[model samples]
Target: MLPALVERYDYDPYGATYIAYRVPSTYDDASQTRDPNLLTDPAAWQPCESSRFGNPLLWTAQRYDPAVRLYHFLFRTYSPTLGRWMQRDPAGYVDGVSLYTYVASSPTCHVDPLGLTYIISPYQIEALIAELRRRPDIGGGLRGRTRTPSDQKAPTNGCSSPFGDAPSGVNFRGACDEHDRCYQTLGKSRFECDNEFYADMAHLCLAYASSEWQLAECLRWAMVYYIAVRVFGGWADLYDFLKWNGHARRNVSPLEPSRPAPRSQPPYTQPPYTGLGAGTPWCPSRRSPYGD
Candidate 1:
């Protein structure tokens, strides 16, 4: 019997396939091997040239035409060669920009995991908040240009108002106060609101709650409130909105979940992957197409 070959892939933080290695099954300690030929061979490994969805484990492209290959990114069909979508975004102009733009035209920094939704990982969120907090401009002037220490003074009554300026803490009142303050100061402008305050509110909500998922749901509702107030210039009762959309649950989480089985097998699940040349697998086995 022929010795089985084991292939391992290494990816960058952005899920880009940077290096790959193939080793014989007989090698008990492959990591200790110091073979220069094995390390330097060009044929042994290939870097992913495509911008978005570089990790082959998660992304599977279909060859509809003999000459061209297209990937179904859930939102639209993407042509790798053209580096654009074959179809316009299904969400229309919700991004308030070009529907054809990919990863908000920033592939290096951002990734659209589901193709339909743009998500920043919890680690990324934490890092971003830390960086933002470090900045003198944002941290020093969190209460807005006009507001001073006196203006941020706590309400006279013992009960905390959502708009009150208080340091974020484990208490829900503190979290809500911080979120409202973020909305007032940073969320007034759409650019600052989405980029800075929204994430800050998410962090604050998560910080106060014991259940991360439940707090995530609250964050979603908070976003809806911000959108209604700032974008549409309308009022929405938070209680009414939450009650109406009670069925809505948290889908995104900070920690990774176990890989679920694919709903359906792809057409190219089997071997004899004729068109795809050497190095690439016929289809990923055991490993998930979603990122680890």
Candidate 2:
């Protein structure tokens, strides 16, 4: 995920945004042909402004909080299918999210209720790999330019080139064809991903929202579970637990450990959280989308 950067201009009065999956080469070129105008140009080969978020030409402010930017970038680009599913079935996802938040904020954190453990089975790992192979849209490109979800593969270890002659052992276990079918068949549906693995994923997300404990532990747990699930077989017990409990797992409060998440921070942000650095006031530009 790209960190948001502010660019200045002397000629053209207004500047633009640049949202890219991969940083452009110009940014690294010795000659530095990385002109903001060219990079953000609507006519550029990699038209970034076309994303669901407003056009770079017209949009003037980053919509996300600075701290959450990394969170959004990772989750958004890495788990588009999961993100979409969350949007489609928010009630279901919210149940898990809420439980995670409660655990994070609770005092006397003796045991991390949200810190889930799992042992990935080989079958699950193969299934995940198959899903990757199925996604040509994310993988098919020249040499080593392809990108996959952070959880799916690592580029440095050489998993980027899905079609290379000397394919890396880090290569996706399954093919893109299978990934497509699996994704399509399960789009926004309550299908089980390795259930044993989810306790860990849920914890990581909750960690992102908290500052109370050792989030690093949560991250480590997430990675371990991810590798296990993607490299080994899937976990059937976790899947059964999620299913048996139904799609929504209600969180119980101190008094009622069964009640739904006690309306924590409301789903929506109260005010737009434009990330202007502290001490410096945010002076909205008249022409900017976030007008004063």
Candidate 3:
């Protein structure tokens, strides 16, 4: 049997209010009908029972209690309407003087997924990289070029690419070796190789992380390694292909119209997340079509 879709909710800038799905139907007052899913005017809408489709979960995958209008977080209850926690932070006041303030009132910059303490949001992944760059040991990994050590179809021994070898507080040698084997295998597609590599590294991080901080830190390094291979891995393939065909491009005559090399595009940034966004909107729109 096919699964039924529950009510879809559109959260406001503050994650306070929700606009439910509006089913379309003909209204007597107008030739056509369009009344915000028809729930606003039940008498005008098709069926009165349609209102029951709403889901209990709201912003950030947190359960919302309509009775108290509070978000049930892992460590504390939060009032998105007030942009404050329902109780003092369990960790006490380390971020600021107020224990109830979310992300030191900088929700746009940070997120507290566990309701324990704030961490830099994905929006600041670039900023996080910059911050990490200051640490010599960690930053050194971020600056190098990458290449497979040998053509030996050995996953275990050839897994350490220059970039992957850098210390990121995470042990990815097993996964990296598997990735190398994938790329080195005959007839193995580059896309498949890269994806398998990413999944391998990510799985290692997931299995290794014991805490939220550890998970985030490990994933950050995973992303760096993944990004490195994706950007430059294509060049490796091209070079290998040319060498196998006995026409190394570097030694080719420059007088000829050198063909433009195919560019490797990193996966497109994800679309603006419109579903269940719970973060405090830094730039609240002056006008909302839903009449917020």
Candidate 4:
């Protein structure tokens, strides 16, 4: 029985493939029997100049035409021999001034699969990741990769309180309700939603307070809530995505916050000079508002 020969392939940094195979002459005719033991030996295997596979392709994504020795990309043709694209980029000078550059001329580090844009993974969402890792019970089952952040759904209860369930504690459920809606709304960022949540809590803490001490305590509790959410909040998964194509969208326009113009002061009117009159000075005792 003859041992099956498997072709071995080697690749260079620039998507070039080298193959090792056997000569056809050894098994050319029925009477010409080759040594099976030779096939198993490493010395028997040699580099093949010609490829048996009709379609030769490149690694950073390309369809190779063996006849022309050129790779057919989506928007450009690449010549592995020249180590550059044969045509200009279809997206014009968006990437850079050089139109024929491939992966910014760095094949080993980057890959331009579609011949349009170079892809690089940016590790972001630190807050979200930290929260997921810190609180396993809450974020354990929520780490879903099947859906994007834009597909997040609002909770049926509106505000599933992350704060203490004790009835006497601050009613942060109202803030959470607003936050949940803000998250579900389109074009709202996670940062924006979280900011609004903090604002709502602040309003609640200050609005109904009767005394200065009460106000201070309420603000303290509000700050605690804000800090908790700020540190251990849910990941960016609970918000709408600003851009999709796997790249973070950059806003080209300036984002000047909306602020009303300053109110103009009226001209001061000088009162007529009044005559001074002498009188005995009287003093009143100051009263303590705190009943001290």
Weakest 10 consecutive residues of candidate 4 by summed lDDT: 275-284
- The regions of model 2 sitting more than 4 angstroms off are 1-34, 37-191, 204-213, 234-292
RMSD versus native structure for model 3 = 21.1
Cα RMSD for predicted model 2: 24.3
TM-score list, all predictions:
0.42, 0.18, 0.38, 0.35
> Measured by TM-score, how close is model 1 to the native structure?
0.42
For residues 167-227, what per-residue lDDT tens digits would candidate 2 score against the true structure? 1111122222222222233222111222212322322233232332323333333443343
Clashes of 3: 2
- Which candidate, 3 or 4, would have the higher TM-score against the true structure? 3
- In angstroms, how far off is 30's CA in candidate 4? 25
Sort the predicted structures by TM-score, highest score first. Answer: 1, 3, 4, 2
- The CA lDDT of each predicted structure is 0.37, 0.26, 0.48, 0.45
Looking at model 1, the pairs that clash are: 57-289, 58-289
For candidate 1, the lDDT comes to: 0.37
lDDT of 2 at 163: 31
Q: Estimate the Cα RMSD of every predicted model relative to the unseen true structure.
A: 17.4, 24.3, 21.1, 26.2
Give lDDT tens digits, candidate 3, residues 196-290. Answer: 45544545544444455656666766655654454334335433534553433444322221122124412212121111111112321111121
